[model samples]
Target: MNDKINLNYLESYAHSFTEKVCSEYFGTKKYMSGQEIIQLSPSTQVNLMVIKTLFEKWNEELEMLKANPYFDYKDMAVTEALKEFMNVLSRAIKIEKQHFIPLLEVALIDTVLLAIDPLVYFWGEIEKNPSPFHHLKASKKYIKWHEKLFSELISKGDHADEEAYKKTLSEIYHQHENQLSSPHILLQDLNKVLPLDWDQLIPKEEILTETAPIMQEPAQENPVFFEEEETPELPQETAAPAEPVDYRTSDQGEIDAPKPSLGNGKSIDPALAWARFEAEQGGLLKGPIESLEEGIAINQRFMFTKKLFDGNPDLMNHAFKSIDECDSFVEAVELINERYTSRLEWELDSEEVNEFLHLVYRKFDEK
Candidate 1:
């Protein structure tokens, strides 16, 4: 009736539910909801809110019960009291999954308490029996017993109830400080799943890291090189150099100027200018005609030669030992065309090919 929940009173209602009565009504000979579990209408928030508060109240009561030594009813090495409390909760809390989280938190807390109680009991026994051999051995023996189940349970619930699990583990950790300090299984919580019958699967994580993605630096088009067009310009003659070009022809006694003029320079020797000024203007008098025209001509000659070779391949009838010895392109072409082209007759009649060409030319055998 009170807005505040009473955990003890609720548990009593659960304790009073008879198994036969449970079977008769709810048809399960198991945990019974203590008449107070919230089963509010889907549209109502108030009842759900009250149930939420009661869920917290139940958790507090379970913790209080643990603090009192009297409620450790499952004194067995592995206790099922967590299952018992969850049964009470399944009955008392709203059963719908959307409302189940807090009730589940209750079960988680019970497991936390279950794990913690053994350490408390073992140490308490040591205090009462105080002897180096008896107490130390007693502590180690119980710790060994606890470790078997403790590791598995903590690992399963590691992330499930982080804070409470950590607290419970830390208490057990320090209480049995030496034993817990030994090496732990280096399991990397790496999870994978497959169909039930599949025994093994290649972990995507392993394969992804090992393989490198294919590097396709986008196709770089062959950069085009074109010849700059040459323009005729007047020559600026440079003064003759001291090295004395016997500009005279060796056979005909006459002076020869450098055969072709570089044109822009008026002296045989280059002119001098202030380095800074020349550098600032980005180099003086680089006639685009001299630099780009020569390169353009070279590429054009190479491209033309390539086209001539490809367009009319010189086929050979029989191998010729030498080209200068053979003397002409006509001599080469006459020999090979007779062998390769003469072998096949494409007068167009295979059942498949004729059918394909027929479709292409005649639409179909329309009749």
Candidate 2:
């Protein structure tokens, strides 16, 4: 449970995992599929799932902003910048070793922090020592809220009573589970921390560079006309155009106007793009649940069945199907209360129950 023990274990596990992946797959494949990812250790699977969830939430925010009637021309730049940022993140679809390694490293750190102590993770310690992924504006707000809540909970509880501490944390988490599950609450604000030239942070091979155009032979019967252009002449005293200034840094060591890269008319709805990408990869669904009829995701299904249903696949399937048949979230909750909760004598405030109910709520709580 100590920090050093956790850090050593994580480092050793990650090193071995990375070496296995590189030697076994990196030699031939450019991207790792979700199916392949599912075969990884449970800890790694959960970490990747966290990364995927963050990406989906980021995409959802962009879509929300893009659809606003009040969205103005000024907002368009931010929208497009976010879209491009999502694009770079979509590299996770065909995640190269270069991209995957860094992402996994950050994710593992986050996992360790959360596992070791939720209080420490939410107390702004993670924010103070941020990785690129942690430089999110929403994260600051999220941490601040949790920090206050945890502080209050600690102040009101017996510090000597570990069980009391656990009970208080669970109660607080359950009380705010709905808000905690909402995606927008954690929506990232790229303008706050991400640099204008954020793409440069990625590896050269992982960047989506524009490909060179191919030259085609022109037909002699219809030769194309070309307009000749004159080149500008430089003065003898010209000093190499002053080495082109970078607005991110100035002589005064302050940022000037940082122009984020706009989309090149290639921006598409992130949800649609992910749908196409997931289809091509033939992997389990990684995005948000659009409908219960589509069924619970593989990860969720396995997790819920194991954790809540006592590894009863049939019970899990039937419960989900029954919940899906309900016309509304209220009806779904009633059904769970009557059939599952009451019958199984489930603890409503338990983390597993809250997580399961949260996913059900997501199915019906459409924006």
Backbone clash total for model 2 is 0
* Candidate lDDT values, in order: 0.26, 0.41
lDDT value, residue 365 of candidate 2:
53
Tell me the spans in candidate 2 whose CA falls farther than 4 Å from its real position. 1-6, 33-41, 49-93, 124-367
lDDT of 1 by residue, 1-367 (tens): 0011122222222223222222344443233233422221111121222343454355457657668775564576324655465555535433433343334333322222222233332222222222322223222311223443344323332333323333443344443433321111110100111011101111111111212222221221221111112222322222221110000001121222222221123211111111221232212112222121221111122222223222111321012223213333333223212332233221222222121121111111121
Candidate 1 Cα outliers beyond 4 Å, as residue runs: 1-39, 44-49, 70-78, 89-367
Q: TM-score for every candidate vs. truth?
A: 0.16, 0.27
Candidate 2 lDDT over residue span 1-367, tens digit each: 1111123233444455555545567788887654455343333323343344455456457657767887573567875775566555544445677766655554544544443234334332312222312222223222223333344344443232433433444455444333321111221121122211222211121322223222121212211111112222222211111110101101122222422221122221223322333333222222346665363422344446656687566687788888888877667766776676656656554444544655665566553
**Residue 69 lDDT in model 2?**
84
Worst 10 residues of 1 by lDDT: 242-251
